[model samples]
Target chain A: MSLDPQIAEKLLSEMRRGAIVLAVLGQLQREHYGYSLRKNLVDRGLHVEEGTLYPLIRRLEKQGLLTSEWREEDKRRKRFYRLSTDGREIYAQLMHDWQLLNTSIQKTTGRSE
Target chain B: MEIVDSYLIEIGQHLPEDSRQDILAELKVTLEEEIGDRAAQAGVEPDVQHAQAVLQRFGHPLKVASEYRPVRYLIGPDLYPAFLHTLRVLLTIAAVGVVVVSLVAAFAEGWQVGVWSLIDVGVSLLFWILVVTTGVFVAIEYSGERLGWYESWQPRRLASGSLGIIDRGDVMTNLVTEGVFLLWWNNVLVLPNVINGDSGSFVFNLGQVWAAYFWPFNVLVGACFVLHLYVLMKGVWQRPSLVLEIACNTALVAVLIVLVTSPEIVVVANETAGDQSEFLTNLVDRTLRISLLVISGFCVWDMWSAWRHFKGASWRRSSAA
Candidate 1:
């Protein structure tokens, strides 16, 4: 069976929310500010929008899942965000969820072979 | 330097007052740092134009403005779908309410309940449905589903750099225009400024007692609106503590009823002119009066909700400890 390109794209976009959060958590194990974080994620081929990234950063901070502080770097203060203690716990759980999801997907797709 | 400074100011103008200077400082530092790097790469001396270009590459005023803003959803993400569902339910209920009331009124009048009655019922139903649906859509679209809608939705979040710095100049102008129309059509300006005291006016009006003449009243009204705008921008009003919200809303309804119904009974004779019926005019007058009262009531509710949000944040912090 074949899917229309637009439909497939929309479906992929809709399912990417969880993937984005997981990616953010994994990357934020090391502190990175907004632009650098975006660049790192994109460098890894994960495309996140600036509009999406800033808000997500704030939300993660507010939820106590991420800790952030502004520090002077090369004459400019940049807000560096990293995983909080709670965020570490959350990251671990999310990693478990991801592995389960990944295995389930692999099993279903593998069965087709 | 001039161009970079102006651009930074423009960006700062869109940020919350508390964080405006800090953000501007950061932006300046960022521009300087980035432009220095770019100039080094190009082997050209760093200049104003070069910094401007780099800032331009970063994004425009609106784009940069948005980065510092809380996530806004029309119906807000967390409870918007639920709000939409509830709105549908409310509209259905309001439609049924209008029909039943109109029917009862028609039958009580001992009329045969003719075509005009049917038309009246239809118009009432259509009017409320249109109103409720438009309101729900606006609330949802402006405040609804978004990833960070809830993060800055609290009342104190009104002071947050992201949601707070929004320049509502365009909206304020529009509101002033609407307010002028409301004042003119209602003959509200003609009413005396005296609060619950008699003035040498031709007629005593109940609306005059609770009129929006006083500055404090205006301030309270303005605060309610600001709170509403804060909620709309932050997108938390949709999924706020369900019980607390419902109770606040119910209290508003009760206040509105009292404000409206009181004028009808208390200041009956003063509600009319020679040919004009006091009861009818008073009913219309009181409705508007009650709406203002309810608005102020909601402001008080916003205060409560703000306290709750602060408590929740504090609780979270303490529990983590």
Candidate 2:
């Protein structure tokens, strides 16, 4: 069946919100600055845009799910970010809930996981 | 790099002040890094085009800045319906008002002059009304004093008579009316050379008596313009304004008396007329006189009704006190 592109994209975007947050948190576990983080996400087959990444990280930081500090890297100062202690615990629970939800959906839809 | 500089400057304007520099600094790094990556992928050195491409991907300055800030509406949803209704009524009236004024202009001057009048009245009316409406709404939104508006319920108000409060729509109408009249009197619009009719048209000029009241008319219109402007800004009529309104009406009555009583209101110059000059002049003069008489009646009636309304408003206030 054919679907309208705008509706399809909008559906995908709504679905991506939690996934994007998870990706950012999971990726930030490995200490990357804004550009490197965005690059890594794009490289990982996730379609994160340039405008979407920084604000998400800042919001995550405000929510106590991320920590950042400015330090030198490759002879340039960059704000490197990683999951905070609370962030690590929260991410673990979120991952657990995410996996459970995923398994439930797959079972309910009769899709092979 | 200039493109990047301009982009950052634009973004900085819209960013929240407390975190502006930090946001700009981080954005700058990401932008420059993105450009370098694109350049590397394309096997070229980073340049202005690379910066331009990166900034373009990041989107408009306001869009980018908005992402970092909490969303806000200038006129929030609570007030939106009222705002929309106000705009609808005002703009509809304005559209009709400008066409009517332009028709009057076309009758007095030429059709080309009427077109100019249309454009002049349209721009001034629509632009100022929108600005004033938006400004007023924005002020209300920011003040937050209107929190009561959300809680207040008055079903009776929907069916009640006039509350004597000034209607913003009426104020806007008066403001635009006075403004357009001022523009017409000042000869702000250029007049094109009108082609005379097949039989040729008469050049009708008012007699010296009318010419003598030129500045007086100008000053009179100017004062009315200023008074209405003041009333619009204040959003209510105080005793002083009511007095000023009566004074302006009194002066307008005197001017109308002089204009209508004049023996030679519109005389056709024979040099500019065809063979049927006398007949055309008489026809034109009578029309002019009739128009003046109609206008005088309208003005006097308007003044009378307004004074009566204000007098009622005064009694209401004093009795309430």
Candidate 3:
């Protein structure tokens, strides 16, 4: 039987939320403004909504995982963001955990390389 | 630019006051970039339509703003069930109390008057109690989860909140008993005929010990009345409410202990034959002693029951987080 779309969407979003932080953090290793960051992630096949991305950025900043500053770019003011020292350490740990979990899942599903 | 500015303002209005300007500035820059991108892709100016399209893609302003705010939980999932149960229990007690009062009034007046009173009293009492209960739960919710005992045993994990509801029938019995006692205690129901002889000289009267303890009894009985009303609605025993039950029971038992130990709990003032008066005094004293002792025993049992209800409640998660 097919799963209901709403239920399926909810489950999918929960999984996506788990990975969204990693995706955002990985991109934030290089300094990029908010708009450019969104575009860059979208180009890389990770589509995050404008609304969802801002709060995450602010939360990460508040948690001391990101640092941001406003500066003039292309004749207009823009807020650029990048990872702080703590963010780099956290991102590295998370990447290691993800890889291990991914490997286990692959083996369990008989899709191991 | 005007369209984007207006859109940003609209979104900003719904956001938190502290972060409004910072968030709005970021939003504006992002929207401008998005509109510019769309305009370039289609070979057009970054106009109103482009801004509109970008805004639509972002979704509703309120919802977007909401994502940034701390999640609003007046009574979060943790206490929502108990809140609802408490509300239902209180409403039920109010309705029952109203019906009883209205029925008594109806016998004296008319059926229409009784029905009107039932509706009026039921509506007003329910409304006030609902407000009071909701306010209390809201306070508890915002009270920052400081209750060590509340979460000590995984209250939220219990799918069906251990209402520790002994039974609905038992609650009704307690509710009715408390209602009658409150009326009798307040002198709304004169029991002089039952306790006194035809001459009105006291055959059986409460001793001097009760003079100081009147309001204490009212307060304790009222506390238990509310507790039972809550228990009836909850249908299971939870921690904080059960703690209240235990407290009320202990206080009641304490008062009963004092009353039973008193030398003259019920002074028979009849100056008839010495033997008869003495016999009457002994009978009344024995009866009072026995009754209070029995009630004290029940109170102890209630305290034990309240404790046992959640004694086995274990921590479902290692970390509450």
Candidate 4:
């Protein structure tokens, strides 16, 4: 069945919203500032909007899942962020849950490999 | 450079003061970096146009600043439904009050002047109702104190389904009527053509009785307005609102009694009339008395009904417990 363009777009957005948190947490294992982190995500095929990415980073930092610091590099100051201990623990738990769900879905669809 | 500085300044205007400097500093660096990248990709040195393009891509200053700030509202979601309810109630009251006033004026005078007065009063009531209701809600939202009533809400009350939901339409009608009446009482509205005679135009003005207790009259109306708003906000009629309603109704009843008993509660004067003046004055006086009686009846009914609702709520709470 053909999906409406609006419906397809909505579905894509909803799917991306769920995945983006995991993608952000995974990428934040190493230190990267807002702009560069956005670039890394885009290069890895997740084209997160700058507006969306920046706000999410700030929210995560506020939730104590990430720690940020300001440093000067190449004549410019940027706020770099990385996974805190809590964030690392959360990332592991989320990954495990994701794998279990993935396996369940695959088995139900008879697409297990 | 100046364009970037101006852009930062624009964003800074919307941001909260404590974090404005830090957010702007970070945004400035990011925008400049984006401009540089755009310049390299386009094979040209970055200029004001490039900076502008980057800022445009970043989005409007308000939108950008809003994302940085925690979500805020003039009337947040928790109170929005109540605000809407209160607004509807007030508007309905204004409409009914305007219709009644128009009919009375039309009966006393000519239909032409009455129709014009109706339109004028209707428009003014609507405008003031909107302004006052919005102002009240904005004040409540900004107060930021989650009122004790909200905090004390019990799940059993919801489950019991016995909570008195104030009739949305009645509440709205009362609020608007009270608001419009307050405006009229305060001399914000003066109807010159409400009463007319063969000799000349006559104006029906509130007599010295109301003028004597002017501040108290305002306080009574103001209290009623606040009580209606509180009920509408709470959604379920709570004990505190009931107490306030009864108090305001009692005050209104007293005021109405004093007004009706007082000599010449409404005075009518014609600019060019001689013998016909007494007839017009008596007519106006009788009309004022009748209006006061009708309002007084409503006040007593309101007080009785509020008392019943308050008692019913308490009984329900006890039963549920």
Candidate 5:
């Protein structure tokens, strides 16, 4: 059965909100400026709102989970972000926990490999 | 370029002064890159239309600026209960204080003042009180520091003892009634036509005794109102509030004692055909004495209760230590 469009949108939003932090952290493993990072994420089938992504990037940098520096690129200034040491440590732990939870959920739902 | 400048200006208006320039520069660069990328895909040079489209997709200036700004509140959740408690207490005292002042003014001046004028005074008092209370809470919220005194508190500290919880409803009722009595006592509201007996018409007036003690009486009531506000903000019957309460109640009791012992505080001015009778005068004197006694008794009870709470709070602190 097809889901109601509003309900589908709401569900998608809720799902995206939970994973966005993890997804952003994963992408920042390599250095990328704001515009390029957004394009890369969209190419990978995770469409982040520009308003949402910019703030998240700034917050992560503030928390010391990401490090950013402004550099000249194509004759324009661009702030590029990359995962810090703390970010890598946190990402590894979060990924491990997420994998365990996913496996357990799959087993409980009788969809185990 | 004009549209971009205006858009940036709009966003800058919403942003904090410290970070406005830096944030705007970053936003401008990102917008330009997006516009250029879009133009490249459409096989045209970036133009005003492309800039507008990119800015549109980015969202409204307020929405964009809000994302950068931290969430803020006038009174956050942590202080909300205390704020609400303080508001109720202030409103209650204001309601009572205005009424008392109005009644006293009315009686001293005469009962010629209209009801609407008295109501306007009461409303204006309440509005000012609300504004003052909100301003205080906003100041506390922005300070962004939790009260240092409460840092040592833990739920487990009260495990072996029972702390007195304030009943908001009961306190509110008491405050409202006190406010009304204050208005009545002050002569802000006057009973113009209380009785229309067969022999004569009776009007209410302040007795000669009220004029001599009016300032002292008002000062005592005002102190009590301030103490209640302090207690509301503290959200508990702390030592300071309890001590203030005791002092205020003692003053009130002393004043009531003087009023009751003296001959009369309420006078009935009869505007009728017949002369005023001795019996009616005696009755009015007796009623005033009885009312004073009741109020004094309430004050004594309040003092006793405050003393008990003061001791209890001290005991808990000692034991917790």
Candidate 6:
């Protein structure tokens, strides 16, 4: 059965949001500019666009989870973003939470026998 | 070729600003390549009309363009929260800036005089420039590209810049002039007393400080020249202003003016008064005088340069407007 476009859009949007949160937490430990971060995410199998990357970087910086500075690279300038101390702590916790959830779901399905 | 090219251009019109060219190029190639595939798949003659219809049925040009692009959000899940947070910080800073300005004016000098001082003039000029520039860019970027609040408005030709001309000689000459003028201003008018000092080193000395005090006009003239050079280099003839560039230049101009011209030098010197050593008083006086001269010169130069550089540029009216 084909799904309605509206329902498909909503479901895909939620999935995308969850993916972004995970992707951001994973790569932000080291500094990366928006373009580099997008490339990194794409390399890791998470396709992201320039629009999404920049605003996300800004948001993360504003939230005290990231810090950024303008740095010279290849004789051009780029703004590099890195995880803050609090961000590192939060990211670790988030990973732990994700693992626990994944294990619990697997066990519940395994027990359905 | 002419008929095929027009068809391709029509499809190009619907693509987003950032990826329009790339997508168009890819589509053109795909059409050329896919013509063979379609002819083979259906076993038809190399009919251009059939190929065109097949491409059309695969999707509308805009829809196909969207599919090729990776998913993006302007005010996406990642950025909206941060944006709201930034808004709070900016509002707080503005409030604090206003209170500080008022307090400084009330306590330092007559309110009316303070209101009309050169410092006040610089601050107001900077404030309006930032507000107006940001507003205009935001409005233009959004409307021109049909971008949503959080969508990226990447222009198609960002790599080469938006200008039609590619004359390197003109740009190089401007930069050389700018750098030379900057070095001259710092070395000469601002440090006259250093040459006059006992050791004759390029550093500051007694006769230099007195000379600096005597030649306040030189400070403004030198500063004006340096500032013009910087404006020519940074704004008029260089790369376009990205978002980060705009933020930095705005903040730098505002902070520099406030720090340089507040008569804070006099205040600091006065605080060091009542010391027993007459030599200390002289040192404080000299330091304040020299610093004020340097700062005033720099400010005047920047203001003059910004005005002059922008006035002469092709985009002068648009930028100023």
lDDT order, best first, reads 4, 3, 5, 2, 1, 6
Residue-level lDDT of model 4, residues B64-132, one tens digit each, is: 878888887988998887787678767755665554554455456634333366467678888999999
TM per candidate: 0.44, 0.46, 0.59, 0.51, 0.56, 0.27
**What are the lDDT figures for the candidates, one per model?**
0.60, 0.76, 0.78, 0.79, 0.78, 0.51
Q: How well is each residue in A1-113 modelled by candidate 3, as lDDT tens digits? A: 88689998899899999799999999999998988888889999989888898888999999999999999999999999999999999999999999999999999999997
Model 6 CA deviation exceeding 4 Å by range: A111-113, B1-321
Task: Put down candidate 6 lDDT per residue, B1-321, tens digits, no spaces.
Answer: 344467567666765687566445534543554465567778876577766764665455555545545465544444445444444344334433443454355446523322235346446755765565456445544454433544654766244432223233443343333333333333321222322223222222333223343334334333333443343333233334222223333443554345445442322222222333344445655666666566456445434443444445547547768
Ranking by DockQ: 3, 5, 2, 4, 1, 6
lDDT of 2 by residue, B1-321 (tens): 878989999999998899889888888888888898899999999998888778888999888888998768999988888787677667756655554555466557744344465677678988999999989989988887473654686776452334244556655665566555655554543343222656775566667677787688767765765676565545566566666766776787788777887888876654455666777777777877788777567557646655776888778979999
Query: lDDT of candidate 6 vs native?
Result: 0.51
For candidate 6 chain B, which ten residues in a row score worst on lDDT? B188-197
Error at B64, model 2, angstroms: 0.8
Q: What are the per-residue Cα lDDT tens digits for candidate 1 across B161-260? A: 2212212343233233333323332333233322221322224445454454344334433333344334433444333432333454455455545555
Model 6 lDDT, residue B171, Cα: 32
DockQ class, candidate 4: medium
* Model 6 C-alpha lDDT per residue in residues A30-108, reported as the tens digit of each score: 7786556766887888876433444466656767988877677765456677889988988888889888887898898
Off by over 4 Å in 3: A107-110, B92-113, B146-150, B154-321
lDDT of 3 by residue, B1-321 (tens): 887777778788888899899999888878888889999999988788888898898888888888888788878887887787677667676755754564465456643332354346557887899889988989988987533445577756553655444766666777767765665665544454233334343366788888899899989997887777666765666777878988999999998998888888886556543445666677768987998899888789878877776564434322433
| Model 4 C-alpha lDDT per residue in residues A1-113, reported as the tens digit of each score | 77679988998999889789999999999999888888899899999877777878888898999999999998788899999999999999999998998899999999999
**Residue B206 shift from truth in candidate 2, angstroms:** 47
Judge candidate 2 at residue B175 and give its lDDT.
57
TM-score of 6: 0.27
Q: TM-score of chain A, model 5?
A: 0.89
